[model samples]
Target chain A: MEKKQRKQSPQRPAFLKVLQKSGLSFLAMAPLLLGVIGLVGLFQVLVTPKMLTSLFQGNSLLDTLIGTMSGAIAAGNPIVSYLIGGELLEQGISLYAVSAFILSWVTLGFIQLPAEVEVFGGRFTLYRNILSFVFTMLIAVLTTLSLQGLS
Target chain B: MKKQDKPFAFRGKYLLLTVLILYGVIFLVSSQSVQLALLKSGTILVKILPIFGVVILFTSLLNFFIRPKQIAKHLGQDSGTKGWLWALAAGVISHGPMYAWYSLLEDLRSHGMKDELIVVFFASRAIKIPLLPMMIGYFGLTFTILLSFYILLGALLQGLCMQLLQTKKM
Candidate 1:
């Protein structure tokens, strides 16, 4: 009976060891996964026409630029993307600017940058970001013109 | 003596079998859409098998050829802005979903990389070299040029802002 009990105990520890290693990997991936799911849920809730209309009531190019910047500031949550995309389209915001805004809102999260800084070093991180920003605007302008041609 | 190993292996197989059976039962209780999604994901993976293989092979190459320590040595504190520039170029050529690249970023960070460079890595996803031909075909050369310039410029601005505003955080 003692031998049998000893065997049973070893089984538990062996199983537990496997569980522990896999568990840590899962934990590391959990935050980003949850963030994505939460963003999707948020996208379904707040992406409405009226909200965007109120957000971008003005016509100035500068206003559009500001709008994009604000979008970046509020970044994360795809719901914002849908809402802003709709509003920008309705408000006659240039496709170039709107595209840039959408891209930045997702790709460039200024609010999240601090968190990123905590993970990546400030200098290398900053230089990489500047390059990304440049690319974002470039894509936006190009997308805008192409969209114009289609229309 | 070799035969004794069979009992231990059998027990391992039994445990795996038990877990799989339990998973199937739980999956049955889940929504039908969840099942459909799994099926759909499998189908998509099959369709993209070649791309998937190439990407996986590339990822392995990155792991083998570009050790994080090497990247660190070039982009580490003493290496300065020049190191950062090369880091961005390397980031551009790399592939996979954002989440997949996190570990690599973690590796770089541990090797003394800055956060601003990490942000640049995230930002450079906009420039897909493989898709450039398609984009040019659809958007025209002028629009493509302007868009590429804008993205690069915006990324540069973002990096500078973060560097100036939060250098010590990382």
Candidate 2:
């Protein structure tokens, strides 16, 4: 019994150490997390659906740019993007615009920029966002063309 | 693990203070908007809290059990195709909001995970299993398949781009 107890004692301290480290990490992240949530909330209230939809002017390049920009600003869940994309498609918006919107809506995040920068570093965050934004436009155009070609 | 290169506490505090000041200004302009914003923020906080708990617990356990060498073996600079495959699979399986995953990624980075793999993980998150049905309903089966393929491809391409760019910087 003494041997077993001695063997187990090391793990107990390790577990406690883990717990303490986790707690500290959580506390460290709390303020930044709260700030991100606050910004998302403000965005939700300030950016309306009509305001987003009105920006697309039907020119493929222009609409694609507008879609990507708007989606980046209003980043949220993929589900919400699908709903918004569907609505836009039904409203006669080109697939290029909707595709770009959906892609950037899920990929790019302007509101979460600070939190991402804090976690990943500014250069990394900037490069990733820029690359993702550019890819979103490319993917949007390609997806639309592929669909058109198939149909 | 290497210590964080930059201190985050001061920046986080400043961010929080700025947000609070913004709220105060918005409140003065329109109390109703402020109220709505607070409620929305509260809702988001509630939603993310549980995920945050899971992330912290997972990271702590990982820190305790997984050595930096093991992480390096699987996801390090020399981890190769296997590492890319692992990152792609992990990214596809990951759920919840993007912010919730940042802490875990940071933990992994400390344990020697590559930055390119991190980009792959983020890019692959575009494909959500739970939301696939809804996506198909909206965009149809063929489009969904094509987009999913493109997203996976894009994830790899992006990761490669990041690796190249970082290498160039070095």
Give the best candidate by lDDT: 2
| Model 1 misplaced regions, further than 4 Å | A1-27, A41-55, A62-91, A109-151, B1-68, B80-82, B94-100, B130-140, B166-170
Residues A3-88, candidate 2: write the lDDT tens digits: 99998665443767787777677788888888888988988888877788888787878888999999999945578778888888
For residues A1-151, could you state the per-residue lDDT of candidate 1 as single tens digits?
Answer: 9999997664333434434433343344344433332332232233333454456645545545655565555433334454566556666766656666656665655534433444444755565556556556656656566556755
| Candidate 1 residue lDDT tens string, B19-126 | 345436646775453454345434433443454345444434444555556666776666677866766675567554343355446645655676566665666555
Question: Largest TM-score belongs to which candidate?
Answer: 2
Candidate 2 local lDDT, residue A130: 85
Candidate 2 segments whose C-alpha is farther than 4 A from its true place: A1-13, B1-11
Candidate 1 C-alpha RMSD relative to the actual structure:
13.4
Q: Which candidate number has the best DockQ? A: 2
Candidate 2 predicts chain B with a TM-score of 0.91
